[model samples]
Structure formats: C-alpha cells, structure tokens
Target: MGASARMRLQLQPPAIMAEVERLLAGRTRDIRLKGELRRLFQERSWPRTAKIIRAWMTWVIMLDALTLGLNAVLLPRAIALSMILPACILPPAALASAFVWTKPRAFWLQRLSITGGMFFILMSVALVGVGAGGEFYERHLNIMLFVATTAIIIFAVPLRWTLTVAAMALGLYLFFQLHNPRLETGSAVAATLFFASGIIATVVARRTMNILAQKTFLLELRDRSRVAELADANARLERLARTDPLTGIANRRWMMETLHRLWSDGMKGRDAAMLMCDIDDFKSLNDRLGHAEGDRCLVKVAGIIQSSVRRNRDHVARYGGEEFLVVLPGADEREAAHIAERIRQGVEAASLPNPASRVAPYVTLSIGVAAQAPDDAIASPEQLQHRADAALYLAKQAGRNRVVLHRPDPPGS
Candidate 1:
C-alpha cells in the first residue's frame, strides 16, 4: 500500500476500541453505584465526593496533556505531521475538562472517551512500526503515562474495577511491546518500575477502603446508642411528671389534665363528684409530733384515702403537705361523701400513736363534696374548686371529722 493510504487506515477505529469502550462504560456504572452505596451508609457526602472526583479529573487532564505535548515535542516533524494521533487525543481531554467544569452526569461518556483515546494512541504507535523501526516506548514517556492512568483509574472508579481495568490495559501494552521488541533496556526497566508502583497503589487503596468501612460502622453504632439512651430518659421524665412522689398516686397536674379531658368529654354530670379533704389541726400535729411523724401520718393517710377510693376512675392525689383531692367520674355527691367518710374512718381505725390528738386521739379528716350536672352553669374549673373549698371551710367550722356538701345560692329568697 502507498504511504498515504496506509496512514488513512491507521486513523480508523479498530475492533479492540469497541471492547475498550464497553469495559469503560461498565466501570463507570460500577463507580456510580459504589458512590451511592457510600452515601446510603452516610460514610461520605455526595457533593464532597463529586468535588474530589472533579479535582482529580482536572489533575488527570493536566497530566495527559503534558504526556501528549511531550510526545509531540520528541517526535520528528515529518513523523508527527504524518498522523492524526494528536487530534484524535485532544477531544477526550476536552470532554474530560467539560465534564469536570460543567458538572454533568457524563461519567460513562467521559470514561469511554478516555478509553478510546488510549486505544487509538496505542494503535497509532503500532501502525508506525509498519514503516519505521524505532523504539515504540520511551522510558520516561511510559512511566509518565502509566502514572497518570493509574491515578485516574484509582480515584474515579471502585477499587476492584480500577485494578481490573489497569490489569487489562497493562496486559495489552505488554503484548504490543513483545511484538516489536525495540524498547531499550532502560525503558523495560522503567515499565517494570511503573508496574510495581501500580501494585503499591492497589494495596494502599484497598487498605483505605477497609478503614473507611470500619469507621462508618462504629459511628452508626454510637448514634444508635445515643438515641436509645435519650428515649429511656424521656420515659423516666414522663413517669415522674404524672406520679405523686409521696403517695404513689397521680399528681395534681396529671389529675387536672385528666379531669379537664374527662369534663370535655361530658363526664361532669350529676352522677360525677369531687371531694377535697384535709387533716384537722395538721400544723398542731406537726408541732406536737415533730415534722417527721407528721410526714408519716400524711403518708399513712394517703394510703388509706387511695384504698378507700378503689375504682379505676376514682383518683386520689396529695394536694399539698396535709391535704388531698379525689375525683370520682361516676359517683353522686352522697356517694362521694360516703367514700370520704370511709377514708376518715380508715385513718381513725389505724389508731397509731398520735401525741397531737385533741379530740380523736389520732389523725382525722374533714371532707367537702361537690357535684355538677353536664348542663350546670359552671364557668371554669376554678369555680368548681372554689365551691369545694368553701364546703371544706364550712365542714371545719362545723367541727372536724365531718363531710359537708356545697350549698347552692338561694334564688330571690
């Protein structure tokens, strides 16, 4: 064939170029999937990884441009001008730059471009051997190309895929070298050195991946533990807020909220009742028996009151140091007074030592009862409380240890 015809034949794509493109496309897909997996595990942020990949791509483009420029400079003007090799290469570098700068999802396309560029460059070198008998690889050039390719592959792809592609490319390059045997001993040694360097990089990358995986697992475990501890603490706080510390009954806050909810649900009917009771002469009792005995008496009285009001909706709470409140959602005023009387009787029956006894020789309670129909003209919860408190004041005035009912105002007496 004539020299010009032969040169045109060298510029056309070879069968191997299609295979290189397919492999690179698959590698790009694997790299994208691996990155998504890392993000799913929260091991690395996607934006950060993308920035790093782009920066690495920029460096790779720089290195490849340097290699091509050097190769162009070293070639004789006649030889360099005779081939379309340089033009074939510039497009891939330009695509890679655009991919980096424009931030497109062209990972596969960019990779395919690079693979085609390498295959085309190798073919050019191979076709040149048909006419001229010069060394196909210069030591410095092979070393630079190998370094640049290895860096790009390791940074842009998963470890296994990177190693696989590197192995295939190296094998093909070695096969070409075996056919032409024109490489100087120094060039062969440099190839070997570059090959050794690739092995070292593979080892380092694998180690880094293992460390990243371990760190991710430990951080996930730590976060789970912290969440569990916080949930447990919240449960304990809820329990404390709802329970009376001294009596083990529902606290006033919990009882008030429950009563308001029940009242809103139409529980404040004529059958529902509330009772407020207090230990008679509790301050004198504390003075005579000391606060310790007073506390014991209060505890004992709370237990008795809770026991007397033993229905599911019958709630008792220590209203204050020496007073208690009870809510009965389905009991009349008389039944509620009876229940309070039972509590007073239970305290009297205990007959434990009471040095503060003025009348009963032990602690006694005066209770007040109030009832309301669902249609009653009650303005607020405080009004109900005020009526009960007024009844309790009257019970105390009528002498201790008695129950009093709230008196309605007479109309136009």
Candidate 2:
C-alpha cells in the first residue's frame, strides 16, 4: 500500500471512534436542550421550513392523486366513489395552504392541511382495502400506507406534530386490522411490525435533522456575535487613534483634519476661525515642579479651553505639547478673539500655582486668533494655520498672557 493508505489504515479507526463519541455527546446535550430547540428553529429556520413543507405538500398531493387514480380503476365501485371526493378536495386545500405560508401566525393551517390530507389518504386506503378482495389486498394496502407515512415524516415536520400524526395513523390502522376478519394473524403481526419500524425510523430521521439544524443556527448566531464584537473593536480603535490620551480631547491629527474641513467650508461661502493657545511658561513649571504637576496643569487648561468654547460647532484639540488649537465654524475674527480672551481668563482664574512663571503668579495663556471668509484666497489650510501661529508669536512677544488677532497687510503698507 501507498504511504497515505498505510497512514489511513493506522489512523482512521481512532479518528472515526473519536468523532462517534463526540457526536454521541452532542446528541445527549441536544436532547437535554430540546425545550429550546423549537424556539431556535422558529427564530432562524421557520421560513425555509415553511417553504419545504409547501413544496412537499404539492408533491404529496400530486402523488396521492396519481395513486388514487390508479386505485380507482382497480377497486370496486363503492371504494372508487369514496376516493373521488378526497382526490377532488385535497389538491385545492393544499393549494390554499400555500397562500398562507408567508404568514407565520397561519402556519398551523398549513400543518393541519398537510396532516389532514395524509390522514385522509390513510383512511381511504384502509376503507378501500376492507371492501376489496381478501388477505392479499389488505397486505398490499398496509405496505402502501406505511410508505405514505414514511414520505410524510421525511418532510421533517416539527416533532410534536409528527408524533401526533404518526400516533393517529398507526392507531387507526390497528383498529381497522382488528375489525377486519380476512386479515390473518400472521399478516396482522407483519403489518404492525412494519408500521412500528417506519414510525421509529421517522423519529430517528427527524431527530438527526433537528440536531443538524440547531447546530447550523448556533454557528450563525456565533458568527453574528463575532462580527458585532469586531465592529465595536474597530470603532474603539478609530476613536483612540484620533483622541489625545492625556487631555481626553482631539489630538493633533484630528485637529489637522478639522482645519482642512473648515477650510473647504470656507471656500463654499462659510466663515471659520482658528485659535492657537500656548501655556505661558510651561517649561518653567515642568522644571520647578515635576512633569506630573505639569501634566495636571495641562489637563486643567484643556478643561478651561473646552468649557470656554460653549458653541456646539466649535472643537478643541491638543495641537502638541503645552499647546491647544480650536476650530470655530461660522465665527468671525471678533468672535474668535473673544473666545480666546475667555480661555486666557478662565485659566488664570483657576489659580494653578506656577512658582517659576514670569507671566503671572498663576499659569496663563498667549492665544492667536485667525479668521477667513469665503472671498479670501487663502490657498490652503496651512496658510490659515500659519497666520494663527504668527499671531500667537506676536501675543507672546508683546505680553505672555493676552490674545492677538492676525491682520492682512494694507494695500500700500
């Protein structure tokens, strides 16, 4: 034998045995959890199951009509007449059941129609067999009925209804056999055995299919849960990417994107403003007190800036170390300057002690304000940002704790 065949011969038995054990364990757990099976099947597989039932109903109706037609030719007049009404009524009833398949509340009507049709077929066969020749006819008819029961069970109806229909048909068949004198003891025993075997097989087949269906539903649910978790994780990662860890505000990258968006809006006839803010004597604070104290001061200053810009359209970002930027849409130079002044005052009012500071006894800010209207030809967002930076330099040059606005050069300056 080849290497693969040899390996298979050595390995296949253990693998098959292991799989068999696993399946047995799974079957036991499924039986224990059978109460939940109906609910899960309804939630995930009801529509498909309904369609299968409808299709099977159509096929069963066709097959029943064909069998009845053949039997009508061979059976006596009374049996043929009895078969005629059911053959005429059942196909139409099955068609009507198809119409309600989409309506879940009306599902029982389909089940009843299908089970009722099967029961009628069983009764018709029994009736025809009783009125026909002898033991030969009864034996053949019972076999046919067993085949019909097996067909119905193969449609995989829910277990409760399956059991109900099986019980009714089997009980009716036994009653007929007991009443009929021509059915010999041997024939009766054989018929009963066949009927019992078919029912057991039906139950086993339905249970196996149910187990498979439940496993598929569980896998789908797990996949959906994993997808939702992945989506949530992606959202959190995106938020972290754009947010400053220290200040709990927009970071430099987000601020740059906001500047670009505002600049685009500015080109479309809207006004936007930017304010650059620097903590006065931040290096000195970090030097005298520890960097930990400097971090606390930055957090306090960030809160002040965020609170000072009360408009919902405005955003604040930590541009870099000890510096923050604000974007205000639809704001003019005056509004931007006013907002910057409030931020400077708010920081000073907080009275964060800065011993090494020259600006004030407490920490303060130097802010630069720049505004652009739609008509202005500021070629890019960088130009507006540069103007804000220059104004901030001017603010620090003149005084460490004040606001300064950028001005374009006059026509003849």
Candidate 3:
C-alpha cells in the first residue's frame, strides 16, 4: 500500500513502504519506476509483454516477405534485387531480438536487444524506399514513424526505451532528407517539426500509462493487507470475550453455553459428570491476606485444576467468586470422584499458607462430584449443579479439604 494505506493507521511493512515512496517519487520525475517495485512490475508484466513482442515480430517477418515479392513484380530488376539486401537483414535481426524477449533475460540485455532491433527495422525500411526512389522515399519515413509510435503506445516498456526509439526514428528521417538531392529546405524543416510533435506526444502518453499502472498495483496491496489485519483483530476479540480475565480460564458464560450443548445431546449427556470446587475457608483467607494475594491463590488453583483434568474431554470454568466448575463427559461417579480427589491433592501440595484456616496451615480445596446415568432424573446441567452444590455444602459441614459424592434423597422421604 502507498500513502492511502499509511493514513489508515495500520502498519505497512517498513521495507514495502520504502518501495512505495520511491514509486510515488518516480511517477513525477523521468517515469522510471525504481527499486523493488521496478523488479516486481517487470516480473508481473513479462508474460504479456513476451506474447506481444513475439506476435509483432511474426507480423514484421510476413510483411517483409510480401514487400519483397511486390518489389520483384512492380520495380526494375536492379532495384528489386537491391531490395533483397534489406529483406535478408530484417528477418534474422527481428527473429533473434524477438527470441530474447520471449524468455527472461537481464533487464539491461533486454533493453539493448529491443533498441537495436528497432533501429535495424527502421534502417531496413529506409533502404527499401531508397532503392525504389521517388514518392516511396518520403512514404517509408512515415512507415518508420508508425512503427516507433506503435511500440511507444503498446510495448509497455519504460519511458527511456520509448524515448530511445522515438529519437532514433527522428534522427534517421532528418539525416536522410537533409542530404537528399530532391527535397527543399522549407519542406524538410516543416516535415521534421511535424514528426517531432508526434514523437513528443507518444512519449508523454506512455509515461502517463506507467504512472497509473503502478498506482493501481500499490492500492491493491494495501487492500489485501487490511483484510489480513481485520481477521487477526477479530480472532483476538473472540478469545477475550470467552475467557476469564483474572484466572485466564474459560468464564461462566462459556461454561453455560457448553452445558446447554452437552445437555441437548441426549446420548452424550447420559454419561456426564459435574465437579463443583470451592477453596476451604476462601473468605477467611481473603480477609486475612487481602484480595491481591487471594487473586494469586485463585490463579494458582485454576492452573492446578486444569492440569489434573483429562485435557480436551473435560471442560473447566471459573464459575463465580472463589468457585470453579468442571464438566467431565463419558464419566461415572467413581471416575469423577477420582479426578476431584486429584484436584484437591494438587492444590494442597502447593504450599500457599492461609493463617486463619482450620484445615491445614496451607490452602486446600473441597470438591463435590455429581454424575448422570441413563435412568437418572438429572434433566438439565443446572440440576447437576444443584446436586454438586448440595454435596459441596455437606463437605463444608463435615469439614473442608476433601471430595464428596452427591447422593440423591429417597423418593418417599
């Protein structure tokens, strides 16, 4: 992207920005695109340029053959034979030069071939006209100018090359007519001035075309870069929306959505279990150590709980203040209790001291396990939460720093 991309306040790669700056500066000067942009522009245009150059060469060859036959038929034997000289020179030069353009070559060599081919072609046309004499002499100069103008308009080469072709054609015409026996000074000056005007116009037209093409290329790059940047920003925002900022784990909203999905799957939810975990005497710990240390404890506990689970199969969430929840799919009460016990041990092993706690001198966890079977009456994930919470209350009542299983109340009780 160029200047317009920079204004968007998005970052353009520094190296690419430098190239674009060079391009914009190049536009107003000699119309030669420089640096990395020049190389890329050449590579981009090469295929089409090759085809056009080859086609033009083929046509020039065919036209020269046709002209040789016509000269043999309509002109004197000596003059027709004299025209044979240019025909021999033109085809081989055109063919060799066209071959160079058809494949990739060094830019300097490419320009050299093209400029040399143009001058040879001009000279061959003038030689044919001189052999035929009279009106054909002036007409051949017009033909030379036509060839140069067409190259300027369609070749899509840089301005310097186009200017080179134009200058050579003008120089050839003025040189031949100035030394001519029949042509007058007044007519020669008028003809030269008129030819010079056409030359100037074609060169200016080619310059304008190059500037516009490079500008279009720059804008297209900027648009692609903006699209990539937008996609990355959207991904970061989505991650932030679903994650708990403090604990760096899944939040309550994500947990609820996942629960809804799991419950809706009748077969899958049948073998699911829920573990609701609360730190033993969390409020007392927070009161004694302040919220900063309490937040540190929460983060540490969340990490331990995550590490203890079955990875992708288990869903973990920071449900609310000092409370965490985990959902285990395809698990029974025994398996759920075992995982919950692991979580309890992992936290107690971390030696974060809570002075007010009656359980252990260090912090500890109490987890409640509730599971669903095929025949059980746990209709939704909320019912699982209520059961686990009930069990959690029992664990707190009996004493903290342990795991408890939720046993449903009997039907007749």
Best-matching candidate per lDDT: 3
Query: lDDT of candidate 3 vs native?
Result: 0.83
The sequence of per-residue lDDT tens digits that candidate 3 reaches over residues 1-413 is: 24543443235577776666555556354435567556666766687788888888789889989989987899889878977886577788789889998788998988988899988988888777776677778787788788778877887778788889899999988877775667987787789889999889988888888777767656555565567679779988987888999999999999998998877766446788999999988888999999998999999999999999998899999999989999998889889999999999999999888887989888999988888855776547888888899888888988989999999788998
- Candidate 1 regions off by >4 Å? 1-207, 234-245, 248-251, 264-271
The candidate 2 region of ten consecutive residues with least summed lDDT is: 5-14
| Model 1's TM-score against the true structure | 0.48
Off by over 4 Å in 3: 1-11, 14-105, 116-137, 175-189, 222-231, 254-276, 307-316, 325-342, 368-400, 403-413
How far in Å is the alpha carbon of 162 misplaced in model 3? 2.6
Regions of model 2 farther than 4 Å from truth: 1-41, 54-80, 84-160, 178-182, 259-270, 310-312, 411-413
lDDT of 2 by residue, 374-401 (tens): 5677436677778899999999999789
Error of 2 at 104 (Å): 4.4
| TM agreement with the true structure for every prediction | 0.48, 0.74, 0.70
Per-model CA lDDT versus the true structure: 0.61, 0.72, 0.83
Candidate 1 per-residue lDDT over residues 106-156, each given as its tens digit: 556545544554454434433434223454444423543464465444444
**Per-residue error at 381 for model 3, in Å?**
6.5
Ranking by lDDT: 3, 2, 1
lDDT of model 3, residue 44: 64
Worst 10 residues of 1 by lDDT: 28-37
